[model samples]
Every structure is written in C-alpha cells, then in structure tokens.
Target: MRMAYLILAHDNRAQLDLLIERLLGPGGEDFAVIHADRASPLWPELRASLPEAAGRVHLVADPVAVRWGHSSLVEAIAKLVREAVRLGSEGAHLISGADWPVTPREAIAQTMREGLCHIEVRPGHMEERMQTFRLDTRWLRLDPARDRRAYAATWELRRLARWVDAARNRLGLPRSRPYGLWAYGSGWWSLPADVLAMLDKEMPRLLTSGRLRGTVCSDEHVVPTLVAHAFPERIAAHRRYVDFPAGASSPRMLTAADLPAIASSGAWFARKVDVTHEPDFLTLPDFHPAPMAHPASMRGKLPVSGQA
Candidate 1:
C-alpha cells in the first residue's frame, strides 16, 4: 500500500525528525506530509530541509497557527488530507508530532486495509460540546496558567458569544451544530482513500459553514461525527495506541515501563513518547526498522506509492 503519513507538528524537532527517519527506514516506500504550526520555531528548519531519509517527504504550504482545543487544529488536518489525496495514496494515517511506531510497516498497512476506519471512539455523542458557544481560541498566548488576566478581553468575547447562543436557544432557534453531527473520537487515527476523499469534500463545508465556528476540539469531533453518520459500517477499532485514563484530559507521557503493553496491544503506533523518559526504550538491538509484509490492496482508490 502506498500510504500517506500526515503529521501535525508544533514543537520537539529532534523527536519529530527521528520519527520521520524511522518511518522511512529500510523499506523506504511510504511518504509523509509535515504541517508545521506557523507559530512554531521548527517551521523554518523543516521547510528548508527534511531528514536524510530516502523517501518522499513534503512540507505543507501556509500552515495555520494551531491552538489546542481550537478550530485551527481541525483546519490543519483538513489541509493535510487534501494534500495526501493529491499524492494518490490508498490511505492516510493521521499522527501527532509526539508519536512513534511500535509495529513494523507492513502491520500498519494491513491494519489500514482491514476495511475499517481506525478511530478511538468516545461513548455517547457529547452534545454539550456544541450546544454552548465556545471561543475558537480562549486566549491569545493560550497559556492561562501563566496569566489568565491577560486574556480579560477574550473572556468577555466568550461571555458575549455564550449570551448570544443562550438567547437564540431561548427563542427556539436551532443549535449551531453542523450537519447535525454529534459524534466524537480521538484525534489520531487512520482512514482509507474513500473516506479521505469524503473528508476532503465535506470538511471545507463543515468548517466554513459557520456551524463549527465555536466548535471545541473540532479535531476530535468534526471528522469522527462525519464518519459515524455517513459511513457507519466502516467504523472499527482505532489502530494508534494511547491510554486516556478515566477523567484525564490528556494522555500520559509513555515510559519504558509501558513497552510490554505497547508490543502486546494490537496497536501499530504509540503516542506522546519522549526520549527523556526512556533514554533507550526503542534502541537498536531491542527494536529494528524494516519492511513489513504487504497485504491485499485497499478496496477503492488504491494508487500505488512508495511505502515501507
């Protein structure tokens, strides 16, 4: 399978470079498209040159400044999907800058060809995320921990938007949810070519129709909602491995202690890895990069590319 690895990176250049290098290891078949946040310092270096790996890698043009839990994250993924489709790959895998591969390349491809959209589904539709108005970005610097008072104006704007939404609801106006989409899932996942094409068609409309304008964590909601409603049959297990402990908003940073579970789990990749936590977790003798066994082709739009 010719696969497109769509990466959304903001910081951690060394880790990002290592992830790409390993991705292009011995098999050297798959290609990647990197979208560096415009506000990130790594943008200039990544755009100037990629790692010395022997695979096709491209930088996204005019990347949007991505803020956590904001609409820009959704916009960035949509842009990546459009670029991947243009490359004519059979499938696209959406990954974070902090993720690293745990399984061989072939296993990853096989998982993608299993005729299921691999997204980590959250229980229930989580209707409240959209019923209330949310600020696209709640703060300018986005570090309320440092100075919440600095964003007094932003808080006022959010308050005003909430009042407007409340008034509309009181007047019996419809909620601003787009396409009546209510499903939710994890941000990191993979999709077959047809779904990629479907997202390409629908994402622009969903993002710009003014429905998802105040959508919180649209990255986790918009695409998953579309898949749940439009292609419910294709929905299956998520391939990426990350643990979200009950009531935790973020995944725990993986350590060497988790290697056994990572290898045992059916997941092909693990996320939120940092070299500092486990200096030699993915070392040479323990883990090696090579070609994986290629499986039968993905169902539709399987244009061959150079993947590992």
Candidate 2:
C-alpha cells in the first residue's frame, strides 16, 4: 500500500529534513504531505529545500497559522488528510516533524491498510477540555514567564473564563460536543484510507458546529472520535512511544540518552524529539532496525503513569 506521511510541521528545518529522510524508503514509493505554519519565518526556506520530484512531497498551499491547544490544529490536519487522499495515497501515518520512527520501515509498513486505523483510544470523553469553552482570545499571546504585564492580563481573562465555565456547569447549562462520544489521546495517529475520507467529510460539520472552537487540543480528540464513530472495529492501538510524565501537560523531549528505552519500546514511532537541544541525537546509531516488540512492553519505558 502506498502510504502518505501526513506531517504537521513548522520551524526546525534541519530537524524536519532529518525526520523526512528517516521516514523515506529507497524507492520513494510512498509520499509526504507537509503543512507548515504560515507564520514561521523559515516557511519559504523549508519549502524550497524539499525535493518535490514526482510529487513525492506536497507542501500545503495557503497554510494555516497553528497554535497550541487550539482548533487551528484540527483544521490543519483535516486539510492534510484531504490532500493526502487527493494524492492517491491508500492510507496515512499522521505525525509531527518532531517524531521519529521506532520500528524498521518494513515492520511499520506491514500495518498499513485501507480501513484499519492505528491509534490509541482513551476510553472517555475529555469532558473538561470540551465542557468548557477554552476560547482563544485574539490578544497578544506572550510568554507568561517573561512578560508579566501580558501574563497578568491573560491570567485574569483565563480566570474569568474559568469562573464562567464553573458557574455554567453548576447551573447545568447546555454545551456542545461536536464529535459525539469523543475519543481522545495524544495528538498523533496512523489513519486508514477510508478513515481519511471520513475525516475529510467530517471537517465541514466540525467547523460549522463550532463545538471545537474553544476546545483544548481538539486534534487529540476529533480524529479518534470520528474514526470510532465510523469504523469502531477497525481501530487499533496507536503504537507511538511518547514519554509523558504522570500528570504532565506535554511529553519530555527525547535525546540520545533515551535511546535504549526508545529502541525497546516496541513502538512504530517516538515523539517530542528535537535536534536543536541535543545535536548529537541525530548522529546516534539509528534505532529503527529493532525487532517487533509487543505493545505491552511500552509500559516499562514510561517514566511515570501516563500514555506511552
């Protein structure tokens, strides 16, 4: 099957190039569809550097300005999925520029199919994220640690929003749950070809419903939820090793020091890696040739009680 590596990438040109190179096979049989942030200064440079021969790499036109924990992320992924399908890819492995392959290409290749989605499915709806309107106030978003003035302002706004949401909850006010019976997890997955089409079809509904307008990190929810809604039996575990500390908001960035756990995790991919912080990581012995590992072995690699 011809799979598309549907990557949501921005900045880190060297890091992104390395990710693409590692994912590519010698024959260039599979292709990639990259959606870079329009706001990034390196957008043009990154686009110019990629080898676009034979339509192997399709950089998105009219890119979306993505933000952390925002609906824009959902929009961006939907666009990428539509483009991947249009390019005639049977399925897609949705990932980020910061992720690396955990298993050999051949091993991972065996999982690609038209209707089976490989993803981690958290059992219940992320009620807090969807129940409250996590509105993205279009004001100056500054680093709270560095800019006290902006931080104080945003903090007050956040507090007000939180109070409102709490009052509504206490009052039993109605709320919107766009993707019904939401299934959420880490914002990464491998989607089947049929699932890609479903996601593409569902985008208009999501955008029009306005349910995800203020949902925190809707990317982690929408895809898995919709896939389960349409093809529940085709769902599979998301075999990606992400070292999240218990109760941590984000995964720890991977370095060469974590190579042992990463290699033994029996995962198809690993995430939150950055070559900028540890330049030597890229030069470390490649970890992709590992033997097929059982999904249960991933738990041992975790530093805390969280998703793998």
Candidate 3:
C-alpha cells in the first residue's frame, strides 16, 4: 500500500522548495503528486527543479489558479483526488503548498495501518444561526470563465468577492450550512484509499448541494461536513497529532517558540514555515536539513517542543 502526498502549489516558490525537501527527507516509501497553480509562471521552474527523491512524481495539467476562498480551490483539490485514484495509491494525503511534516514517516504509516486516521462524512444543517455562513459567495459562485484570476486582474473583483460574501451572510443564506450539520476546518489528515475513491464519486453532488453551495472557504468546512453527514461512522473523531484551534482553517504559524508545540502535537504534519523570519532553523538542536533529493528519511534528535 502506498500513500501519495498531494501538494497544491501557487506562487510560494521558496516554501514549496522547503516542503519538497522535508517530504523527501523522511525517506519512507511514498509517492507524490504536485498540482502547481496554473496561474503562476514560476510553476514550470518549480516543477523542473523538483529533486530526484520524489519517486513517480506527477504534475497535473490544465492549471487553474487558486484564490484562497474561491471555487478554484475546490476544483483544484477535486482534480487531485481524481488523479490520486488514477495513480492507484492506497490513500492520498491532501496537503497545502505551505505545509510540512511534524512526525516521522514511520509514525504516519503506523497510524494509517491502525485505522486511526479519520474518514470524513458530510453533515446537514437547518438552524437559524447557521444561516449566517454563506457558502456560495466566494469560490462557490465562481464560474471559471468569469472568475479567471480575478484577484490578479483588479482590486475591484477581489473587493467585490468579499462584499458579496458579506452580503450573503447578512441575508442568512450561507452557502454551506443550510441543513445545520456542524462543519470541520481544513488541515492535514490521512485516510484509506477507499474513502478517497468514495469522495471522488460524491464530489459533484456535494458541491452542488444547498448545504454546501454557499460555502466561501471550502477548505475547512467542505470536506468535514461531507464526511460527517455521509459517513459519520467512518470518521475518526479524534484529530491525529497536529490540530486546528477553534475557528481556524490553518494552524498557527510555527516560529522559534513553536518548535516546542510542534514536538508535543505529534501531528502527522504542520506547516507555513517562513524561512526568512526563522533563518536560524539549522542551529536548533532538532533542526536538520534533509538532502534535497531524499526528504522522507531525514530525522533529527527529538524536538524539545515535543515535550511541551
């Protein structure tokens, strides 16, 4: 059984470079698929520069540039899932362009074998308070032709996307929570191949559902809601090691101070490490740069933060 690390990339070239190094440094048997955002010119260089350790790496085509909260995010992710299934991986780890692993490769594989990894289900919502979260305003409303790189084109469309999203909330027609099922935020998680295959089948219907149609930030809320509702019994309720704080889609950025937290979190992965801000990463005791070509096998003395 193989786990494919599915990375979604945009213009974060520096970050992407670091992420590839860490993933390959771990050096366990793993495969990867990179979906470089079509909107950026740097993707080609980034793809070309990818190190040799990323065995069987495949980059998806027909690039659609992604806006954080828009439908392009959904489309990009769905496309990856389809490719992961086609690649015949046992499961795929859905990750962002800015993420990195917190745990060793062995631990991650063990969790998967034990079935501790969560399987998501979609939920239903019908409460009055739920009306405020608009699912369709941002990416949900996106028509690829109409929404093409709106963020890069003008300040107005970006502003309009925000304004329209706020208006939807005021009117109480949030794109996602129509049926009142509690939603989960987007972060790193692992799953069985079968679960991903199921997700491939359900993608279209879930996207169009009234409960999810208005969802603006599809990352955190979309998959969790779908998993909870459709396969509640399958989801492993307890989060792995790294966890999102309440109301946060991404985890807090890791800093020098955060290393302690990273160690303790035992999270399979954590991310958004800005090398510029934390340049002394190599000096830290737990810090070790994996050879660029082989990422998964890089291991270090235990992180002090792990004790926290």
The candidate maximizing lDDT is 1
Worst ten-residue run, lDDT, model 2? 299-308
Q: Provide the global lDDT of candidate 3 against the true structure.
A: 0.60
Q: Give me the runs in candidate 1 sitting further than 4 Å from their true place.
A: 136-145, 151-155, 245-247, 284-308
How many backbone clashes does every candidate have? Answer: 6, 2, 55
Sequence-dependent TM-score of model 3? 0.67
lDDT: which is higher, 1 or 3?
Answer: 1
- The regions of model 3 sitting more than 4 angstroms off are 25-28, 47-50, 119-182, 208-213, 237-252, 275-308
Query: For model 1, how does the per-residue alpha-carbon lDDT over 110-229 read when each residue is reduced to its tens digit?
Result: 778876888866534676676667663545355577667766667887888888888988899957555555777887888999999999999988878777666677688888888887
Write the residue-wise lDDT of candidate 3 on 183-224 in tens digits: 654435677787677767776556555443434555555556
**Candidate 3, residue 252: CA error in Å?**
4.5
**lDDT tens digits by residue: candidate 2, 224-298:** 778877878888878898988899878989877888887777777888886555544455444345432332443
Q: Which ten residues in a row have the lowest lDDT in candidate 3?
A: 294-303
Error of 2 at 217 (Å): 1.5
Ranking by lDDT: 1, 2, 3
